[model samples]
Target: METQLEDLRQQLDKQCLINQELQRQNKDLEQRLQEKEKLLQELQGQYHELDGPSQRPSNEPEFRKSRAAVISSEPIHETLDIAGTGVKKTVSETSLIVKAIQKNDFLSRLDDEQIAMMVDLLVAFDYSPKDEVIKEGVEGDSMYIVADGELSVTQAGRNLRTLNSGDVFGELAILYNCKRTATVKAMTNVRLWCMERQTYRTIITNKSKKKREQLMGFLKTSRTLKDLNDAQLSKIIDSMDEVKYQDKDVIVREGSEGNTFYIILKGEVLVTKNVNGHQKQIRRMGKGDHFGEQALIREVLRTATCTADGPVTCFSIDKEVFEETIPIEHLELFDDSKVLQETKAPEKSGPSSTLKFKDLLPVLYQEGRHQGDPVTLGVGGFGRVELMTTLVHGKYYAMKRVSKKHIVAKRQEEHMLFEKKILKSIQCDFIVRLHAAFKDTRYIYMVMEFCVGGEIWTKLKEVGRFDEPVAMFCTACVVEAYAYLHKKNIMYRDLKPENLMLDVRGYVKLVDFGFAKEMVRGEKTYSFVGTPEYMAPEIIKNQGHDFAVDFWSLGVLIFELLAGSPPFSSSEPQKIYAKILDGVFKYPPYLSEAAKSIISKLCRPRPGQRLGNTKNGIKDIRHHRWFSSMNWHKLRMCQLDAPTVRLIRKGPCYINFDRFPYDLAKAEEEFSGWDRNF
Candidate 1:
């Protein structure tokens, strides 16, 4: 309810601001109308004062000659399709065109006689009811005025206003090579009059010195080319081509390689991305927005697909021109490979076994020596982890340093204590080993076993979605870890990809024990915690939950691995929880029935009926049909080959480890009793 209310408030504020802007424009238009009327009266008075009755009817031929002089030097063909608008007008429509032009603001500045002469250059168009007359995001070469019927103005899928007979639009397109600001749809079968770019320029250029001024004005407003030097801007101005688009055309495609960068000149377009299997609309790009420039720096695929909402237009610069014009500094983009810890042994090296906590402790703690200036590995609300090395043993480890202030404020002292104790006691090949805990004035720190492969979350995204075998390998390790923790009566209340890391050998290990709790037989805890996507129905419903919750999360993780989205995934938390309670989701056609069956049995909303929660316990999951062909013993001994692979090592900088160097190390505050048990 609070989220919905906040969203409504933001939308209301946005609409109110737009209404205020429209009010200002309406006032200015009114003031301009009054001034135009005054100017017309003054012109009439001057005509009478200068000519009087001496002006003769025979001078009509000379008057015609004066009108002809205002036309373009290079004559455009009459009775032609203007700028591919698909509608043509003949001299027969001159009077009607002139009358429509007289009602427009900027074009209305011309005298009736001048407007009549422009009839040769103007085009007439007919649109059926609901026809898109002008599309937003599309560059337009012509400006339109409603000769009859009405049109609706829309932007970003929202209707902002309406236009009736004599209302002018698309002028910005004709005035400059830019995207359409909004879509104009024919509300009724409409007759329209239009003036193309060349004709509009001739009208402005022949009358005054506004040609250079207008081009300069457009150059100033360009967002894509804003970073270019004056010389570069000048070159683009001369070489840029005029392109046009009609309604519902595709501008760019996601995942396809792109070489051109586009800046909208006119019209609105919808930006969408492939989220799971759906076309998720991300945003609407209108005037001034630049797209496809990221492709210019180096080879990369188009990140989002763009389609015309209606008719759209824009300026496109090729890679060659962009590279030359835009000065790109040589900066190395962060390689994701560096973010994971090295987990694989070198070629010819034998199989590596998981080291014991007792063996790694001495390597982590050096006598009379401290770790070097910390290079941050990662950070979150839980606190920060940094790269640390020993002086005597020359071994490396991950040191998780947490702020005491945050722990005290959130009243999580008990949770912290449980985490430290649980981590120290657990001994599983697939679980991260906690060597020792210490404290200073402002922080409590833990020295943990370093897994060269970074979080599985990072690896999962890189692969898009995992294949069944890879998913099986990763999940098997997690299942074994859960089996161990459950035997010790420690419930892993939180389970997700972010807390799982891969070692150099591509073996997975569970980390972070902040949410783990010890529970004896017939004991249940009502701790309302866990990630939204994987949180069990019982936790969300405030019902007491047990180790079954971890199994529920495992099902969600498996689904995410196979389909790239959780079965009950939703942007809204309430909707997600509702979906979870309903406990229903369609399996993709490509997903194996075996995988579906296991997830269904594990995620059963009623904990009593859920798998793993059965009397057989964790063995119910380990012995499931999905792992029927597996040798669980080999996986425990790190003998199973990973479908997606990496090998890594420990060093001053493990390239596989992520770089997030934030210095949380502050002067030690004196808090002796607060960290005595740490």
Candidate 2:
């Protein structure tokens, strides 16, 4: 019995030992399971980081390189597309990725999570109806996509068309640092989603250019561009730029040279031109319409000018690509009869011809009777405008000679063309007749109608202020000339006394198209290309503008003429720009209500609020009390005369004309106007 009991105890001990070993093994297995779960969680977190709802791991081989041999392979697009199948699917598809990566319109059409990601990539803008969205001839730092409402595009003084919903603008200026092509205006209260040039650069860096190219390829499948070949279409895509403008803004100006073409991806615009000396609305354009094609061809001056009818947006193309992609051969086949009627040439090139200035110099000199002399008109960074005179048959004619150095530096080719085309086409006493532009490898000569009385700038210096009659007459002439140019779809950006040449009779003859541009309706351009003192606030900010700029300039000119200085004069251009943005034109103590009213209307900050941007601006000015005794119809005929004459023995010296290698570098260091830097 004792031996049997001992055996049972030994068996129980053996069983207990076995149970303890089994429990130890089970605890070890549980610890290993927890370790596996932690590792899996870490892996999942890493995967989420790489391919989140907002971002995805690109198909770059480098990204796929790590742990490739161990993991199962899966295409990123296929995986994301499948995973995001229905809910918020639009925000996850490759198309959204492409759009988001490009910083395109993804922000405008995103789900809540996707919007949060996109909001990180945008700038916001709010505008009231008819606000100027962009200005022509100003440099731009950003592009915009409309989040809501309507816009119009304009060139010169004509309304092109209207744009609504999902439109993009301001891309061209951001892309090339070129001038704004057209003015964009809000047709209704609107909001714009903005992106800067830096943002675009970031996108390009983030998504390789090859991916961008691929995306563009996919986009070209849209119907509007279906007719074009892939190569030609790609050229257009590559050349695309963006611009924005406000209602009644002038886009392109008639008679100005342009090196840009535009595609109206969104917005409305109007086309207008001087038809038989009248501001006539010829046509209107809208989304999918393109303009400035003439620039893509031979460097012909612009024909009709355009203006924004409402807030507008557009994508612009550079001239090089625009020229290469478009069918120029088709343009040659264009029936000129459809564009312009055959007008009889004036007998003996009265004031209009395509002849060189030099060729016309000898004839005009011989017919007019005068002695040769050298005189300078302008100075400073722009160099000078020197009168190169020679006597022929007792008549002396002044040929304004601008050196190649100055011409090339200031990029005056477009300006020269503007003066030539419009001035040549019209015969107006108040308008400076631009005879011809003669180039001789080194020097550029512009044969101008001799203005022996000197610049109007000097007149303001001589007399503290002009009497009402004198001021009215001079202002009227300038207004008429400006009206004509605007009617012809041109905007003279640099409007100051320096550019206002006077004929022998002291009649104000508007001169210098150096900063002139043909505005297209419903188009925007960006270029920081104008003199600061004369620049409008919109110009300084790189917002698009139109013919309304002329009105602002006129307001400044009138104030200067009356008060002997501009209301916003300052040593700093920034200060001046700020003042302009403030939209205040301080009236002198004794100014007339009529003059004040006109200036106020003209200087309004809102392009749409300004008299000039409105269709009635011209008529409104015409009916003002200051012009109560004036005749609009007769003024249009250029029959107005100057009330006083302050003639100099000779015009100013050519020492001021655009030139270099002269004593100017030292002289400019001394003089105020000449010394100032932009």
Candidate 3:
């Protein structure tokens, strides 16, 4: 009987333990539900705020006008004084700067010469104990390297960390215009070597500009390359590799297989020929002189031996790169037998006749109007997209209806017009075509080519992530689009899966040009605009950015496609920017070395060093091992099968997109005449 009582007691203990576990799990689930509800409420508030423009301030016209004006109207053009007049540094100070920079991720990418130049530009400043070295929420223009003593970092009255000698601070200031994030107070008497943003920009800009100009001048004077246009010349300049030779060094040996074309930048080269088994000097080539044109045209043995007369620096391009940039017919000009004929430029075609605003007016307002309701394809912060069909032809197009009141309230008038201008100007197969645009008193409308396969973002969400082949194919389509745009001197600032849409054929088409801007070659725009996760370090710093910013975003897109998330992401924009500036992100183990390498090259902190930004332009990216099997020509022509083909439905379907409620209301006040030309 005692044994039976003990068994009952053990059973009772087990039941109590199980009950306790169930209660704990229930509590956890309840907490999670509360958190989810909070998040959902926040999202709904944002949605309403975006969809309903009436809540936005209507009496801030001056502020709205000034907002667009804040963007610099002129490109920054600061020339460095090359007279060797800069801050003089002591040997110890120079060593300190070097050490400090080497330990910094942002500055470590600089080459030895650039580092030396920056070190020469550093000015010394001393701070006393308890003094504020830098304050939070103040725009900073100078970066400092601690030469001695210690400092304390604080943000919002909270102690963050301590800094010692060799530590760097305010580095972003030197890179771009940004408010200091944290306050730094000197804990001891401190000496810092500082560099100003203007000085730093001058050094980088002058160096790059001078080199490009010199190479361009050489190419322009070359008889073999004279037929090439400025754009083609730029490509050649980017592909050329800098080679230096010591005195008496043989640059080319007679009778060796030659396939490289050379242009001398500095020093001299002595051209000699083997005459009667003896090397006899024939001619001397100096700076601006070019040789070996025949080698690029066809495979041939070197006819002459060229030796460096002294220390010589020359730009050399491989035959493959040379041929890729210049057409074979153009290269054939090097041969006397080939006639140099002028090729007539193709006639530029305007927008399609069927896409005229007048033609679409009937469909939108009269006979072809929808009998009941239009299909809401997608919704966005500014407006919504709807599926519109013409009755007579039964052709479908995506009509983007943006609220003018929302645009004005958000101070996006300039952006809206600019987007229309850019869309109308560009014509590429990989880019969605803008068929028509017209605005009413209430909203501005854009008729764009309907993409049936829908946003890559939606597809990615459904599948979680893409395999290597799919990612590569998608990336390739974007590459083609960017190549076209970059060549036209346009920068597509916003690149995300949501902006990338697939057609019925599963080919990717880039949509949305709200942030697109045309920047002249070698010029930088100081616009701090882009998606947080995809923004480059330069863009985050508000430093001047050019086409290079797009490449950085491209890297992020590639990572997101393969890994299912961007390399740097956070719930907060500030955290995302911090991660971008830190330049530390993990690559998934499943990613191939080639994929990682291309991503790394594209995501370099220095804009000038990014893969597509280099002189080789987009060729470096195209030739990357990750895309070794890519048939660029075929892809551009849409001949290659897209990886998303299996996922796409047949003709004019919206299966990939989520349906949104038609919540847009009529404008309370009319916005007249601003969009007359749209």
- Compare the candidates by TM-score and give the number of the best one: 3
For lDDT, the strongest prediction is 3
- Pick by lDDT: 1 or 2, better one: 1
Least well predicted 10-residue stretch by lDDT in candidate 3: 61-70
> Mind giving the per-residue lDDT tens digits that candidate 2 earns over 176-286?
344576788998999776766554433332333333354355435544345554434443453355588899888898888887766664578888889888878889897
What total of clashing residue pairs does each candidate reach? Answer: 38, 107, 2
For all candidates in order, the CA lDDT equals 0.66, 0.57, 0.76
Candidate 2: global Cα-lDDT? 0.57
* lDDT (10s digit) by residue, model 1, range 491-579: 88667777888877788899988778887434345444666668887665433466778889899889877775567654344455667
Q: Which stretches of candidate 3 lie over 4 Å from their true place?
A: 1-75, 78-85, 111-113, 136-139, 154-161, 179-181, 246-249, 266-286, 308-312, 332-417, 424-463, 468-493, 501-509, 519-559, 565-678
TM-score, model 2 to reference: 0.46
- The residue-level lDDT of candidate 1 at 667 comes to 35
- TM-score for candidate 3, please give it: 0.58
Q: How well is each residue in 416-534 modelled by candidate 3, as lDDT tens digits?
A: 99889878877799999888887777888889999989888877765657899999999999999999888666799889888899988999999988888887554556555667678
Q: 2 or 3: which has the higher lDDT?
A: 3
The Cα RMSD of model 2 versus the native structure comes to 35.0
